[model samples]
Target: MNQNETQWDKLLKIKTTGRDDSHSDQYRYPYEPTSYMVLERLANSGLIRKNNTLLDYGTGKGRVCFYLSYQTRCRAIGIEYDEAIYQKAIANKETAVAGNRSSFILCGAENYEVPVDVDRCYFFNPFSVEIFHTVLAKLYESYYEKPRELLLFFYYPSEDYISSLMTQEQLMFYDEIDTSDLFSGDDNRERIMIFKVI
Candidate 1:
């Protein structure tokens, strides 16, 4: 990478937040500060246009979806597996929306049904490989039915697994945001990968 890119990666590392593995079945990781930057970049680049539907898989505290709605005019929906996290997401939505456009669901990604109109999806390392595959299968089915453009924003992505899934589905890389600095640790090399369905 160039010097500029190296600097950007370092900057992101300062804002990365480590994953919370406290709960066995609950994948409730807090949003990193760099996530806002990624959201803004996507919005500014016209990747997440106004009026488009956005789904935040495993949304904790609804931070990603809330920021999406607050920054842009996009309709946002968040799904959380943990009851406590779901409740927190609801509360956060209420405070952020103040009678605006946003919603939340208390369900796991595998069990949750994807909306017909959802055009964009966000996943912040929300699930294990098994659950991720399950959610991806649902998304593929939905794409086949609707035949609409779908954008996936995956933070701290598992590139190999995602690539395998993308082979069957028409997905192209849109952007990648380095996020190594957002957490407090020595290993700072996290990234957010954005993909667009063709």
Candidate 2:
């Protein structure tokens, strides 16, 4: 790897602790290296394609989008809710985009507008169910406005809520990847569920 790649990898390996309470004024944890490993695997396996548009909702520090863009040459955009973390993500985006690979926006996930032709959407347990539902509603509206293939990558997903929404919207499950080992302990089983519009 070159100097930029080396630095990117180093950033990916850094694990920032998340806030204890959901309501606390804190940023979400940065993704672990193993987490990126899983994302890389999915991309290599054709789950996330090259040259596709990717949206990382609640993207803290732009780690996922940065890695995806750097590795796959995919167009990536991240939306961060917290002001502090959003600024951090912006800084990270500048470093990653030294090669002009990625970009980010500082805004609430629910309030952000989905791009007209986004191919994939990513979420890493960004917020509460209420906010998730609102985002989904907007996504559904966008789909109706212009029908296209939408591949949703929900890491650390709320399966039950997703299932209900999928049923209501008639979306279909494409795959579910078990990424338990990405976390440190036995209980830290991270799951990535991929869904597509039916």
Candidate 3:
């Protein structure tokens, strides 16, 4: 963790740092917290609003949920598969400034049932393309049932993931929130790709 990351955690009253690959495999990826700077940029992008409910797939330690809810006053739900990390998210919620607006689910991203009100969804290379397909199917089902506006945000996506998303028939490219300038590299994956469910 860096100084700024630690400072953000302290300010938010949540400890969501470090990387854990203990449970990673061919499908699900490791647990890594999104940077505060990226989250700040997302919060200010005007995509998330106070009335919007954002569902974060693979929300390790609830950093995205807590920070977004705090910054945007939106209802944030974090779906974490790892029991240990899920518990940590729950603990963080107990003390988080936006705890009332945040919640965590102890379930795999593929098996999670997308609620009707969850209009905003976020992914960060959390799982394999197969699992991502399954999750997108679930989201599509929800969209058909409720017939509401839905947006999918993918940050630092893998090439495979991007390819898979590009092939989805029902998903149309919406917008991109560039974060390449925030980091010290020429990496092309430093951006949030948004897709609209149609």
Candidate 4:
């Protein structure tokens, strides 16, 4: 963990400053927490509101759920497939500043059901494009059952993920949150892609 990550973890009263690639496979991605700086930018973007409920896929240690809920006052639900990592998230919630506004569930992203109140969703390439399609289907089902504004946020998306998302007729490109300046790399993928249900 770096100085910024440690400071943020200390401030949040949680321990989510590590990466775990042991569980990664062809379908499921590894556990990597989103940086505090990038999360701070997302929180200040004004896209998510207090009334909205955000669903986080592959929420390792529940960092996004805790940080976003704390910063935006929006209800957050984190879905984790790994039992051990899910336990860590549960532990973190016990002392998180926004614990009351956050919840965590242990289940595969493709099998998890999307709640109708979940207007915003966050993804960090948690799984392969095939599984993402299943999750997206669930989101669309929820949207169709209860028509409302639905926003999908993808940070550091891979080419496969972006291409599949672009072809989805139910979703339209909404906006982008650039984070290239925050890091030293000239990588073009250092940004968040925002899509809305159409």
Q: Give TM per candidate.
A: 0.74, 0.78, 0.98, 0.98
Error of 3 at 161 (Å): 0.8
Per-residue C-alpha lDDT of model 4 across residues 143-175, encoded as one tens digit per residue? 999999999999999999989988999999999
Q: For model 1, how does the per-residue alpha-carbon lDDT over 1-198 read when each residue is reduced to its tens digit?
A: 234333433433221233434454533344332345555565676777677999988776665666666667788888877786667666655456421667889887898878889999987667676677788888877888888888888766666446654664467877776666644576433666788767
Ranking by TM-score: 4, 3, 2, 1
Query: Candidate 3 — what's its lDDT?
Result: 0.93
Give the Cα lDDT of each candidate: 0.67, 0.67, 0.93, 0.95
TM-score of 2: 0.78
**C-alpha lDDT of residue 137 in model 4:** 96
lDDT of 3 by residue, 1-198 (tens): 578999989988999999999888999899998889999999999999999999999998999999999999999999989999899999999998888999999999899889999999999999999999999999999999998889999999999999998999999999999999998979999999999999
- Give the residue spans of candidate 3 off by over 4 A: none
Residue 145 alpha-carbon offset, candidate 4, angstroms: 0.3
Candidate 1: where are CA atoms >4 Å away? 1-21, 25-34, 159-170, 177-189
**Lowest-sum lDDT 10-residue window in model 2:** 14-23
Return the clash pairs for model 2, or none: 97-100
